[model samples]
Target: MYVPNHLKWRILLAQELKQAYFERENSLRNCKRIFELYGRYLLGTTYDTFLTYLNQRKYRIDNLRMPPYIVAAIGLLEPLRIASERLRLRKMGSPWTLQEIVEEVLTILRERSSTPLDRRIGQAQQHVE
Candidate 1:
């Protein structure tokens, strides 16, 4: 199939962003990783422009159309939660490991999702693993 110039550009951009995200040191400082991982479901890259949009409240968790626990699991990976002074969630854990956290979040999302589509996707993922 012949791809349009605009779509090709978008595909290139997404690939570039994914590459950058995967290459990051897997820490809260690499906020783009969150967006790269969840941008499709979240509607856009929420963490990519978080600093300026923090108070804007542009991205609502409800927009994800996912279970609350999945949302919460993803929220746990947010830089704000990790950096928060009150909860200090990041420090509460033994160590901050982004890969482990991502895996845990995926497991939570897979186990908690109610939709048939999500379940099928999870099943397919499990089969691949």
Candidate 2:
């Protein structure tokens, strides 16, 4: 299970936030907000591949800080990303059974977890690329 590209940054950012600011319960509590503000905003965008663009700019830069407005912009951008994904998936097909829907949700949650998974069969494909 190769992790999806959109999720990579989310994972990395979550790791950072947990390390810096959150303990277990707080981390779980804020999970949804974190995803809404950061993860989903980044879906389908190659922006996350560029280290300099992440909130803390972990590897690409030192001491320089991301602007507050840029962070706010990410939150602002998430709804469009979510809406378009909804449309795209709707066009694909419908889940005819409750089992299918439950399975899909479980699969998504698993993918988002830190458990090691089999790498996807092909080279990573970036949405922007």
Candidate 3:
């Protein structure tokens, strides 16, 4: 029987494809056994490798510093608390103007200067001279 050239080519191609399929199927039979024995280990290795890759990429994208908003809040929050404490302390005391506060501080300093230890120091200086 004389087959056409195109038919012969088609038949050859079909046989080649069928043979490749069987070879691939036979190769996968070994893989099937290997996977059945070491499936959990292989999966764990793959998962760990993928997790490491993701962490590397994440650090590259944003090195593990605090977010900008959190930093801003920390910067603002402490000063606000300090100011609130200062206001509360001011309210708790007698209401004194700036000049009164200066006068009070000067009086306290003067009283300290008149202590016996200061007078003794002054007398020691005169004797040394």
Each candidate's clash count: 0, 2, 0
Candidate 1 C-alpha error for residue 34, in Å: 1.4
Looking at model 2, the pairs that clash are: 1-118, 2-120
Residues 60-125 of candidate 2: C-alpha lDDT, one tens digit per residue: 333334456654444334343454455458657643454554455555555545444443322123
Q: Model 1 TM-score?
A: 0.22
TM-score of every candidate: 0.22, 0.25, 0.22
In the order shown, the candidates' Cα RMSDs to the true structure are 15.4, 16.0, 34.9
lDDT of 1 by residue, 3-105 (tens): 4543333333333334334333454555455455544444354454432333333333222343456444444544333343323454574664666555555
In candidate 3, residue 107 scores what lDDT? 57
Candidate 3 residue 123 Cα shift, in angstroms, is 41
Question: How many clashes in candidate 2?
Answer: 2
Model 2 C-alpha lDDT versus the unseen true structure: 0.43
The deviation in Å at residue 36 for candidate 3 is 58
Candidate that would win on lDDT: 1
Candidate 3, residue 71: CA error in Å?
Answer: 0.4
